[model samples]
Structure formats: structure tokens, C-alpha cells
Target: MQSVDVAYAEEWKMDHGIMVPLHFLTPRYDMDIIPVNINCQGPPLTPLNRVWEFGKALRRACDSVPEKIAVIGTGGISHWPATPNSVKIVEEWDRDYLDKWLANDKEALLAYTDEDTLKDAGQGGFEIRTLTAISGLCEGKKGDLWFYEPIPIFSVGCTVGVMEV
Candidate 1:
């Protein structure tokens, strides 16, 4: 595994990436959250392979603990955010990616290069690191897509899924 810094912040200012899901999933804000933010927003981004290893490590860590854990990966699929092409939904690309994700196809998921993601799925596609990580966490487990829709007003191919751990 690659060496990376893992720190705990006592005080964290929630961003939309963290807040939106919390708002809907834990609306009461009653559960504890250990937020893990991947560097999917900028360059020198975490490589897809490294992200997969990290996800595996995360699974090991979670398994070592007795507490019940819920891993939620939230991100856009194929919408260009903050760009002129914003609201454009590449349904085909999103669906293809989802297919690989649901199958937990490590080769196909990690095969995506940043340049390819940017060109084919747009910048927001980089957010797929989260999904890829989930694939790693579940490894051999297959996932089910409970919901998926391209909501232009929301500027994302909104998706919800669960891995069979």
C-alpha cells in the first residue's frame, strides 16, 4: 500500500459533499460520522489503483472494530459541474460505469485514467474515486443499484447503491 497521511480533525466544517448525504441519510444528525475525503477535486489526484488499495485498507480497519459501520460513497457520475457544459448528463457513460460498479469489476473500474475520465465523463467524473473505493471495500461482493436518475437541475446523475458485504 502507498504511504499516506491519515489524520483526525476534531472540528470539521461540512461541505456539500458531506452535508447533502447526511441531510438525507441521517436527517436527524444523530449518528457518528467518520468523514473520509479523497482528493478528487484537483490535480495530483489520488491514482485509481492507490484509491483501491486504500479502500481495501479501510475495509480491514473497519472489520477490526466491533462497532457497526456504514460506508456511504456520494458523488456525481457524469455531469460537468461549474463549467459551461454543466447539467450535461452522459447517460451512456454513467450507465456503463454503474454496470462495472455493480459487478465490483476491479479491472474495469481501476482501468479509468484521469485523462479519460475528464474527456469521457467530465471533471466531476473524478469523483468516481469514492465509488471505486467502495468497490475495493467490498472486493468480491456485488452491489445493487437502488436508484439512478439524471437530474439536470441538480447537475448530477444522482445514484444510490449498496454493496453486499
Candidate 2:
């Protein structure tokens, strides 16, 4: 709820900030949404800058939390969004991510670099970074894809998947 003098984005997102809010907005909460950040009473924590570090941290999260919390990973399979030219789909990178994710191959899945992700998927592929973070949160869980669609008009690949606790 950080804001300035005037109004601000009701939902300002960075990294994976939107996930917690989105999780509550779903029907599981009986349509009630809580837009607040929970403080764990520790030093200000920043998400790991690199994927490898992020991968290692998930195990700690799984061990620490004593309750069941569902995590949804939303993003894309592969696409170059906002391109005026023809669409480019990086099926290879997308499939690799999916495979590693399904197999719970933390090391391989977290080793992805921005360069590789963008080059193969495009700038819009940046959204997948959120999915990676979500993946870390879902280590021991299984995921089910709700939907995946490639929009040629928007040059975007949109997908939504859920991992349960």
C-alpha cells in the first residue's frame, strides 16, 4: 500500500509482488481479496538476483511454512510480444522450462539467464521471470495448467497454471 501524495496504482507490481495478491483474489478465498504484504519480522529481503540462488531458497520456504498455501504461476510458453513483424515462438525454451518444471529439476530450471530467455522468447518473456519465482515456491508440489494461448494479434503468449500445497 505504499503511495505518494496523489493516487497510485492500486496494484503496483515488481518481481513477484502480484502473486500474493492474486492468490487471495481467486475463488478459494470466497471472492475476498487482501492486498497487504505480510512482514515476517526479519531484515528486508530481496529476491535472489540469480536463478540458482532462488532455486536453493525454495526448499527453505517449503520447510518453514507450516500451512498449505496454493501458488499459481502465470506467464507464457514462448512469444515475442509487441512486434510489428511476424510472430516468433521459442517452443524449445518453453518446452525445456516445462519439462524441468514438471520433473522438479530445480537446478536446471533455475539456471536460466535473462539473455537466453529474452533471446529465445522475446522482451515480453520477462513475465516468465515471475513464473520462475513461483516455481521455486512450488518445489514439492504438482502443477496443473489451466490454459495456454498464443495471441498473434498481440504477439503474446499467455498462460496460467496452478500449483497446490
lDDT of 1 by residue, 77-150 (tens): 89799898898999999999999999999999999999999999899999999999999999999999999999
TM-scores, in order shown? 0.94, 0.57
Worst 10 residues of 2 by lDDT: 38-47
The backbone clash count of each candidate, in order, is 0, 0
**Cα shift from native, residue 143, model 2 (Å):** 2.7
TM-score of 2: 0.57
Top candidate on TM-score is: 1
The regions of model 2 sitting more than 4 angstroms off are: 1-30, 34-69
Root-mean-square deviation per candidate: 1.7, 8.4
lDDT for 49 (candidate 1): 86
Root-mean-square deviation of Cα positions for candidate 1 versus the true structure, in angstroms: 1.7
Off by over 4 Å in 1: 1-11
For residues 1-165, write the lDDT of model 2, one tens digit per residue. Answer: 111111345765543345544564663656433232321112232222333244335445546778654443445556665465437766566666766666656676656655666577666555555566566666666666665666666455455566554
User: lDDT of model 1 at residue 115?
Assistant: 92
